[model samples]
Target: MSARVPRVLAIAGTDPTGGAGQHADLKSIAAMGGYGMSAVTALVAQNTEGVRSVHVPPADFLTAQLDAVSDDVEIDAVKIGMLGSVPVIEAVAGWLGRHRPPVVVLDPVMVATSGGRLLEPDAEDALRAVLGLADLVTPNLQELAVLAGDALASSWEEALAQGHRVAREHGTLVLVKGGHLAGDRTPDALVGPESPEPLVAFDGARVPTDNSHGTGCSLSSALATLQVRHGDWARSLRIARGWLRGALERSAELEVGHGSGPVHHFHHVQEALETWGTVPERFSDELWEVSAPVRREIEELEFVRRLGDGGLEPERFLAYLDQDLQYLDGYSRALAALAARAPAEEARSFFAAGAVSCTETEAQLHRARLRHAGLEGAGAPAGEVTRRYTTFLLAATAAEPYPVGLAAVLPCYWVYADVGRHLQELARRSDAAAHPYADWLATYADEGFQEATRTARRLLDQAARDAGPAVRERMREVFLEACALERDFFAAPAAASRLPGVVAIEYS
Candidate 1:
């Protein structure tokens, strides 16, 4: 999972109704867990009913706003909407060419939802030129036709063709939306420059609502933010579409104006805060509850159950131990990196101690176990799962913020403690003295390790409290990702045991 909170800038017009343009862009950016900034190109006196008038700011002033943000902050992504005129469009294009933010999503806003023209007639060619600079272009059917220099598409196939043409001509991704078509299902396709056909398509049920006032602006901004967060176009599109769909489904709840109203931008966030409360005390509980399925899956693994019952083959057990030793080497380094970045002395001490424990204490235990099993000089290469998990940890610790690194490493301590306790109880219920993995279970389930887990949980909760909404969201995402990787680590040995001709594991 990507760790940092993306800083996204929206250069667009504004709606006093807060349903479209920069207002909607900022809302979508925040809803998608990004720090949002804005530079207004035009201020429109508009409502859900229609645009009364638009006041364009001078292009130089717009440039000033963009410069102010870029000079101070490192922009991770940019969302462009409603440029209004050729000069304003050129001003934005110039800034984009200069800064070249990592991701750029352009929403070609030609006409408003209430049938008001927002862009000047002579600016169509300029908007086309701007399309070449964007990473992704989100254009509704009407806007797509205008940019393609073709008639309005009456069918989905026609729309996709136009999308491909624009993508091919501009060398960028085009998001073609089907909301303007007459249908029960609303489909959206992502057309890329490399293919004549759409690279991906999402078919969703038409949401029954009249309050989808700024869906284009909202979705474009969401794409910009999510692209920065995930760094995969398909995954970003899927997440962005899911979020927009939810907002659209709940749009009528706002009831803001007489005509079409704004979608409820904070619907999911509101629900999450209500359930978890404003305090950080419930954060750990939330992580545990959300990861209950993974915990259950770990308990049900064939390797775990067999080990608890003294039925796992000796060769497989040794292989698992070898993988664990290899994993710990990388894990210890990640822990030391976290200690180096920790703000408080207590946290630094705790993580530093953990690194020492991983390298010295765990290493001794694994070596002693291997020597007892008559494999004193044997060690296996790290398997695919082990390599991937350790690489993720090292990358998170080295590249992400301190809080994000903390979240990434917390699952290793917490999940092991929980699973250890369960295994110890299972061994106790059924002949603990005969259980082959009794020593390993006791090591993880011991009171000292349990205390360490509690301490880590406490530190993470405090970190979440200190972080803003965007960073907190990022921490949660990283935690969940780490939990899934933990489950995969436990499952790998069992999966390997099922393969043919794999009776005796090889050691180097």
Candidate 2:
């Protein structure tokens, strides 16, 4: 009855301590929603105390494991943790070239929590051999220093410098985790030229806890999940960091291993499973009723048929968009929150794309605002319109869907595309001489708006294709609700009730 999910594979050393390596990666992956597969490089003998010994797997055995996973299951993305030995590293590197999964996330685990070396001294060369093949490589302060070679990371500035260097040198993005930096906020820098500026700094509230045994593995695995599911770097890093923070917060009180404890990977899932038949997601009946009304209007309206006729108009369309953009911005923020709560990489990436989508829509709305001609007053609409839209956003923000929370944003995209096309006849016939009227044509006529609309259509199509029929249906309901709200706002029954002019502000 549940939907099919993305698949992810994790390859790395095993930390029996459960704090730092492949175990952390797998746990992070599953918490996100993707089916998880794994290949072991080595085994660690340790607990909450320290690593006593390590049993490095044979290079041939490592190959067989990688082959077994990649040969059988469809691995959407991959996260690599510690290799433990030169042979292990080489084995993984060789398989990486052969499989070439969509995304490869690497956590360059050269050192451990107790200041021990998980990688052999000569293993650095082997690690570098495969570093360039990754989509991303995550490194902490010490590992970064080692990977960058001797003189490259003598100071914090040098460490930051090496992060950029690593990405450029390897043709792979690098996430330089700055949790070790003495600061009030823990910041991790996502570096790659394809992204904005020098880096996208992901900041998280620093939780003072020593249970961070497998943090490197956890973070990289989380990022890999996002990259695999969403294909966005900045979004992935942002979500991955948030998920790791949540695990740290919740697992702070848990004590399992003697050395470093594992995160509470299934906290939310376990809670729900415990409460399973007794209590479903809150307000189930209400969701059905609230969702149904919008669907009814959509079914009755021939929106999709009109879109096929190419008769869609612009100004009226733009009016609905301003509110929708506002809504998307809030949805993106919610995705960020959901990502924070992710227990695994696959789950984090799911929301990561939503965040990217949020900003993408916001950008279009910003461009549309320029057409509003000056802070020139256009007469205010009713207070209720503003209140309603704001209320919708606030409600989503407070919801607990977490990574899956991105689902809330789906309604706007699919519904609008469906409804807009249907109103093509109205769009062409409507008078363009009025206030919102002139604004609508101007907004839709612009190249940016056209492109934005196309993107929304494409994204929604992708979602429909990827999501299960049930989830798709839910998304459709949400989209219909948004369309209904737009209709209500634009088709205000009383023309005399129109308030004062709205002053349009220029975009910066």
Candidate 3:
């Protein structure tokens, strides 16, 4: 069955400018994969510059809007924002008490960026009552000070103290934002009633952008929506903060208002849409099909055909193993580079493990085989083709993005595994008791190597899916080049044997 989308309701004031209030909340909710709904408590006349005025709707009408939504749809989460008066706050608190949505994130929109008061002086106490009903409370330094009945916190330490006090008193989680603090770093913490210390603290370099309007509203709504999906407060906060940072970094791309403009809420969504429009559904299948000629050449090579029938000379086979040892050294380094540059944890771990396996397991296999052939001490230099292939792989991983690097190295895994399986099948059909090079053939055709190749394909396919048109084109170029290089690598041993002064080295 398909997963159900979270239905999140934003009960807040309206910003026709779409930078803050319910508009920002709705955008954030949708961006985090939730179905968004909003009920306006106030019609706010505001722009990036500042708020001109706020019109509070009648308490009964606000209640009616809230009831209309809860009566029909099941709300998974709610983000409460900008209640202009006591009656409005009480009305919201009343509805919340009755229905009690699974998750409630209250963004205490008390003070604006321009230092204007959004909540009435008399309504502070009422807003506190709503805090008890919320699962999480997001408050800036000014609102935090007001809730704790203390002076404005001049430092992060003072802010945490206020957050702890508020959380302890109300028995709710408080998200303390340090953007108002003076520093190169903007820190945030999730403080709960159970502990004096914050449950989790995130330290991030402040994004240098003037278009950070409605960050608090956006963050709170994102937290509410993400909570429904993850069901873990710390995980939700981590994802929400990362998304907000991306939005802040991309905010400059937008030209919403003259003053501090709204952040680019759909930055990731827009990129994903662009990728979906351009890239094919099965990108790896296309890569394989495009490189069919190269694979056919590899299968037709004299070395591969002779090796499959167990008639290839031992000196030539040892020469190939020697070249592969040199190639694996550089290949492992390239894998390490990919690991360091990977964006996701799973991809990073996969590439890191591949690097380790290449240097240890695969290298040991080559060393043992060469030792058994009585050429253990022979130190033959890499052939021209081997040097060229390794150099190309190293350059791609060092200089290009993750996608391009991934494409350049993929052929080594895919082509080797394909050739290994084909040769294994040929050996199986032969009348001989066993293929002389059965061990080597089985190494590449085994379940472990095949699974690893499949994983590499999956990673490249995902990278292609997320990449832009220009990046995908670069990926295709590198992939085809690497495939051609694989064919040359297979033919290198025979070519080297025929060259002048190429005497086979032997152990004493």
Best model per TM-score: 1
| Each model's backbone clash number | 0, 32, 0
Candidate 2 or 1, higher lDDT: 1
Model 1, TM vs. native: 0.59
Measured by lDDT, the strongest candidate is 3
For candidate 1, the per-residue lDDT at 378 reads: 25
User: Pairing residues by index, what is the TM-score of model 2?
Assistant: 0.53
Name the regions of candidate 1 deviating beyond 4 angstroms. 278-508
Candidate 3, residue 247: CA error in Å?
0.6
Off by over 4 Å in 2: 1-4, 150-156, 193-197, 270-277, 280-508
Q: Candidate 1 lDDT (Cα, whole model)?
A: 0.88
Which stretch of 10 consecutive residues in model 1 shows the poorest summed lDDT? 498-507
lDDT of 1 by residue, 305-416 (tens): 8777767887777777878888999999999999999999999999999999998998788888877776652266677888888998998888888889998999999998
Candidate 2's residue-wise lDDT over 1-508, tens digit each? Answer: 1244657888877776566677777788877776777888888776667768888867999899889887788788888887878778778878887888888888888878766678888878888878898878888877777777755354556666778777777887888787676666677887773532446776667887767777777777877777766677888777777677878778855667655576776665665566443432322233335656665555454432232233333332333344345545555776567566555565566556657866875545554563453322222332365447545544543462321233344444444443444444455665543333433334445455455445534444443444454665555455445556644544432122322233231110
* Per-candidate TM-score against the hidden true structure: 0.59, 0.53, 0.58
Residue 249 local lDDT, model 2: 79
Candidate 3 lDDT over 328-431, as tens digits, reads 99899999999999889988999999999998999888989888776562257667777889899989998998999999999999999999988988788776
